[model samples]
Target chain A: MQLSNRLIKWLISGPPLVFLLIFFVAPSLIMIVTSFRLPGEFGGLAPLTIFSEHTSIDSGLTLETYQFFLSDWIYLEIFLKSFFIATLTTIICIAMAYPLALLIANSPRKFRNLMIMLVVLPFASNFLIRVYAWMIILGPESTLSHVINHILGVLGLEPVTLLFSPFAVLIGMVYVHLPFMILPLYTNLEKHDPILLDAAQDLGANRWQQFWCVTWPLSLPGIFSGSALVFIPVLGMFAIPDILGGTGDIMIGNLIKDQFLGTRDWPFGSTLSIMLTIAVLGATVFFTWLARSVMRSP
Target chain B: MKEIADIPEKTMRHSSPLLRLIAMLVYAFLYIPLCIVIVFSFNDSKLNAEWVGFTLHWYQTLWHDHEMLLAVRNSLFIACCASTSATILGTMAGLAIHRYKLKVLPILAFTPLAMPEILLGVSLLLFYLQVLNLTLGLLSIILAHTTFCIGFVAIIVRARLQGMDESIFEAARDLGATPWQAFYHVTLPLIKPAIIAGALMSFTLSIDDFVITFFTKGIGEPILPIQIYTMIKVAVTPEVNAISTLLMLLTLTLIILASRFDSSMLRDPSR
Candidate 1:
């Protein structure tokens, strides 16, 4: 009976464990090792050792890639710029999503599902198509751009280009990720007790005061969770910048992509990826701490 | 608009006019671009600046384009292979985690879903080229898709299992049934809906994926998203709009079907 039980256990769990360890775990380790190695003569990693006429030389590993990353200010600038864009996107998502989520959560229970489904429906569409849609809307010949430019002309200001600008990039980021913010915030807001709001109102508090004291404080956990979802993906995003932004708009993702495909610098690419992973982990920890404290204080 | 009317009067009184307007504007923001894309697919103009007249020229162009057809074929093939393998592996992982309460399996299954997709793409690229020395092609792309998709399937199935009664499995075992028989008769029938939902979700994800596919798909093969990417980058045409509209229709159908199987699948995995 004991032997058979053990056999059943292995039969069930064994394949997935072996598959993940081989494919997921092994590749992650390879990426780390690749980060420490030197760039080859052409593109990939260099040989572990070079044998000369006289002696065998070990050229296997170096911290040169890390040194280059720390020495340059451009990489740091890109990191900061990416963070700025991500933060702005997260804040905008919250502002837009909060009112909508609150409305859905407060609506009749029968209508709540349909309302949430509407938010998710657009998200189910192809992501590239969503980005491409913006390309059409923001193009100079589109109606929106023409209208804006005409208004600017009437105001005696320079006619601004909408496509391939930071504004367009921000719009695309928020559009692609807005549903992430709404879903979590709605989930959190829906669970709030209505009696608490009634109590606050009975205590002679106005609507705004009730929201500030009771609702907003209670929704901090949702906001933080939503922010993390929006922020992390935005940091690692390359397509939005690549397609929507102007030539000057390069995020850390674009830089990392360039290393592999453009420059063929495997070591530098891996190094950049490792740095990004650290940044993502740091932000996650910070968000968790903030959420915990906010939850405790109330 | 009808949805707004359906809101109960007490709750409607609570929602301020400013809040309603903002919510309406937010819904508009979500939908207007998609409407424009669908409308423009049949447009007669080449520039796509304004509509001239409705025509089927773009759809005809798409039909005649051999490269686009091949890309569609590749995407369907890859989505099928990847989703099937992921469903099998992920169902096992989910069952094991629920029954055995294994420590490491959950993290190994789920971290891929949370991590930035580009990291997985780059790591797999290096592993395939440097360690395995395999050429980048459809096979490599399928393997990469399966690795990430396992997490989605596992999460759904595990959630379904968690909600189920443990007594059913115990009853089967007490009735002189083997462990395998208990799983087959009691557990499999109950979790069927979740398994179908997970499989459908995996299929949709694999088909729509672009970021990971961008890095892992080495040269020469024309995948659907990459084709669309090149078209958008190189030039704007109504043909691209037509393809986008069609892809949107397909995804919409699949998503509706999946939700019908399991409504809880609509909830975010982070929940």
Candidate 2:
């Protein structure tokens, strides 16, 4: 069944590579190219450059679009705000996930299976519908705050605002992405040797010391994987924030979406997207680097 | 990596009341929003939070809302087609890549996994509209869904194939079965769980998709997500809550079906 080396290579890689290069890679290249295209408020094609009324490319270059975006305080604000929200969402997802993962790791098989199903079930619901559900719970007359207030009242404490803030956005993120965080962590946690813990405890390790020393170190793969899984999606998340967040909370995804669809500024939108891509790439590299360094040190 | 995994054993002699409490707290945080939506689904009023007692009116309304109903129909139709197409394409691709020595192919094939979906959406949107010069409705959506879904199916199927004892195919072939017959009777049956899981997963993904759908979907052809998207933008209503609850139930059913098949797929492929 073995073919010649050259023929085998062609048969294996050729068609798929060509297919992806045409559709996936080429389209991305085109997008980047389009990003460089000078933009019109309405619709027109021109080369890119900045400030030279004589410089707007008919067939030449102009930076007006990039300059406009750079100078626009609102654009910059939205960009920063988006990153801040994505980070908060990632943190919230982690906080909600790790405990569930631990419990699932230790739970009975039937319960674990049922819980895993419950974890993934929400994910299969339509994105807009999921957001719609949150909107109902976060709306002005929402029962969420009303009930929270009731419970807090029993304890003689005022209920906290749970809707239409970055808080609500974080809640939505935790709600939607908790499964993602749990799955990888659970996988890693389950892979642990039962005797390793026994061996560690047999040594004279304190509980916190054991956790800080053995458990956390072994769980880094899961932690990092889950973080990436939750964080990447959280970065591009648009549906939840737009639905749940008040005017104050915005993320880069939302900004990019609005620029293209709402503001009809493809150039600015492309620039923002380019920046977001770079940021994501940067974070991924940093995380990977940190992980390697940790591994290498002693 | 070792530290957190070692925490439980160190604390093994003690009960994990704090951990259990935090677990419950987290679960409540996750589901309380869902519970509200579920309760509101029965409300007879426009005001979602202001429930005017229980009524089946929204369920009745579900049958009558022609536009929303059509959108759901479109979503179902597209999902079915996309899942089928993707399962076939991806499985073939998976077979090709795994069985053959395709060094450069996998990296390119799996790039879609790394690339942010937003970039894919925008790029695909441009490719179809600007380059292809064709405005699409259901067809484009199906194509777009398949392009992404194929990767998932391929990965699952390839894993299943890897788990197989290759000698089954050899034995079948030795028993005078043709290549196609050996594959159909032996290999295909063996990998049924993976195939089912792959198909179901892609279906779920197609039904739930938004980002890619957002860019590729044509005007007036609202899918289920688009329907909900438009409705929520106007105002949150109990009916929307009803829709969400129903979707939750449907998705739960699908996930259970998929996962059940998946557990076996990874374990018993060689059996």
Candidate 3:
């Protein structure tokens, strides 16, 4: 009986663990290892022939890949730009999502579900297609831009070129990630007890005071998770920038793609990948700690 | 229930006209692009600037485009296979984690959720090319999709399991049933809805995935998103809009079906 029970446990857990280990964990480890290796003659990664006299130091195991990235101002600029854009996107999403989530949560039960469904329905479409839709809307000659430019023209301002600009990329990022922000906020807000608000009101708290003291603090968990969800994906977003960004608006994701596909510099690509992973993991750990500390504090 | 009624009154006062206007605008932001795409699919001109007249020529063109059709078929095939495999592995893992008190299992299972898609894609690409020495194609794409998709399925199934009553399994076993029989007859039926929901959700994810597929699928036939991507990069065409409208409709249908199954599961708990 003991043996059979053990067998059952293994049978249940073994497949997923083994699959994840082989496909997910092992590949990540390989990427880390590959980042330390030297680039091959043409572009791709060379074999990691360590401590061999026949191999040159440049082509052998070394830290040149990391060093190259650190020494390059262009790469640093790209990383900083990616971080800035991700932060901006997260803030915009939160601002846009908070009231909307509150509205949906406070609606009648039947309407609440329908509103949530409407928010989620756009997510069903292909991400690329949706981004493409933005591309059309933001095109200089499209009606959306035309209308905006006409309004600007009435104000004696120059016509605005909307597409292929940093603003366009920001708009695309916010548009694509708004659902992620709204869903979590709505879930959290929907579960809040209305009695708490009434009690606050009875205790002589005004609307803003009640919101700041009660509602906002209670919804911090959702804000953390929602920001994490939006920020992390936006950090690594390549397709949006590729479609909407101009030549000067390249992010770290674009740089990584260029290293791998366009430049064929596998080691450099792996290095950037490692840096991105660390940035994301670091942000998540910080946010988790912040949330826990806030919850624990008075 | 009285608390619910009084709660609305307290909350409704906060929903000022300005707040309602902002909410309405946000909803418009969320949906206007989709509506525009659908409308532009019928545009008579190739460019998406002006509405010359309403016509189905773009849809006709899409129907006749054999390459795009092939891409769509490939995407569906991959989605089906990847989602099925992900469901199986995820269901098992979900069961194990819920049934046993494994400390590290939950964290390990959800790591994929936190990992950036670019990192996952790059790592998988390098692993395939360097370690496995395997050619990049549909198989690699499927493996990558399943790897990331397992986390989503496991999460859904775990949530379902947490909500489930364990006594049914005990009852089945008290009636002289084996462990396998208890699971097969009792627990499986209980979690069947979650498993199906997870499968459908993963199917949608796999179909919509482009970044991972773009990185891993080297020199092979393009998937639907990749094809659309390449077409858009080369030139803007109304045919792309037509196909996108179709893709949107298909995704909406699948989502509705998935949600229907999920609601039914929630309603008929005795089953």
Candidate 4:
């Protein structure tokens, strides 16, 4: 019986475990290993002979790639810019999503699901195509811009370029990621009980106090999870910036893509990817700690 | 009593008008871009500068675009393969984790979800090209998608399994049935809806995936999003809009269907 039970467990779990090992873990290991190898003539890792030669001499590894990234002020600036944009996107999403989530949660039961569906429906569409839609709307000659420019002309102001600008990139990032923020916030808010608000009110609390003492405190988990969801993905997003951002709007994701695809520099690309992963993991840990401490306080 | 009961309602009515306006604007921000895409699909303009008139010219052009159609076919093919494989593997893992209480299974299952897509893409690309020497095409894409998609499927199935009552299997065993018989007869039927929902969700995600597919899909044929990316890079045309509208409609239908299955599973308590 014991043997059969063990057999069944292995039967059930073995395939997925093996699959992940081969496809996911192995690839990640390869990426990390390749990051340390010296760059070759054509931009990928050096030849197998060189790798074998280096295996004998300190595992044939070098710190050049890491050194390059660490020493470069430009790469640091790009990472900082990505971090700033991600922070901005998260803040804006929270500001927009909180009230909306509150309203939806407070709505009558029959309308609640419909409202939630409306929020989620756009997320079903292609992400790239949605960015394209923004391109059309924000294009200089499109109807939206035409209307804006006409108003500006009437007001004796100069027409402004909208597409391929940093502002357009920011708008695209927020739009693409808003659903990520809203879903978690809505989930957390929907569980809120109205009786708590009434209880706070009866305890001599006014509206602002009721919200601060009741609702805001209750929704911290949502804010944490939602911010993580939005911020991390936005930090590493390539497509939005690729489609909507100008030359000055380059982020780390674009830099990684250029290294891999354009420059064909696999080692440097892997290094950047590793840096991004570490940064994201660090942020996640910090946020998790922050959430715990905040929840523990008062 | 009536006056006292009216207090909460009165307080609800005191919710600010500015809040409602912001809510409306948020919805507009969420939806107007998609609506614009659909609208421009029917626009008669070539450059999409101004709407000349309502026409289906772009749709007609999309029909004749063999490369785009081929990409769509390839996407559908890959999505079907990836989702099915991921669902099977995920369901097995979910069942195992639920039954055995494995210590590391949960963390392993969720790693894909927590990892960034760009990292997944680059790593998988490197693995295929350098370690495995595998060609980058439909096969590579299917593998990469299935790896991440398995996480989603496993998470969903595990949730369903957790909500399920374990007594049914016990009852079956108590009735002189073998473990396999009990699982096949009782547990399988109960988790069928979850499996279907996971499969549909996987399909949707696979079809919409761009970053991972972009890295792993080597030169044979592009998926729909890849084709759309190339087209937009060269020029913006209404034909791309028409195809996008079609993809959106398809995805929305699948989402609605998937949600129906999900809600129905939640509603039914017997399983």
C-alpha DockQ of every model: 0.53, 0.39, 0.55, 0.49
Candidate 4 positional error at B154, Å:
0.9
List model 1 lDDT by residue over B1-271, tens digit each. 2344454354343478899899999999999999999999999999767889999999999999999999999999999999999999999999999889799989899888777889999999999998899999999999999999988889889999999999989999999999989999899999999899889999999999999899889789999999999999998898999999999999899988999988987766344
Candidate 1 DockQ category?
medium
Model 3: lDDT of residue A136? 88
User: Using lDDT as the measure, which candidate wins?
Assistant: 1
How many clashes show up per model? 0, 23, 0, 1
Candidate that would win on DockQ:
3
For model 2, chain A alone compared with the true chain A gives a TM-score of 0.83
**10 residues in a row with least lDDT, candidate 4 chain A:** A48-57
- What is the Å distance of residue B136 in model 4 from its true position? 0.8
**Chain B, candidate 1: TM?**
0.94
Off by over 4 Å in 1: A50-59, B1-14, B269-271
Best-fitting candidate, measured by TM-score?
1
Q: Can you give the TM-score per candidate against the true fold? A: 0.96, 0.87, 0.95, 0.95
| Candidate 4, superposed: residue stretches over 4 Å from native | A48-55, A154-156, B1-15, B264-271
lDDT of 3 by residue, B79-142 (tens): 9999999999989888989999976667667887776688889999999988899899889999
Q: In model 1, what lDDT does residue B61 have?
A: 99
TM-score of the second chain in each model? 0.94, 0.87, 0.93, 0.91
If the candidates were sorted by their DockQ against the true structure, best first, what order would they fall in?
A: 3, 1, 4, 2
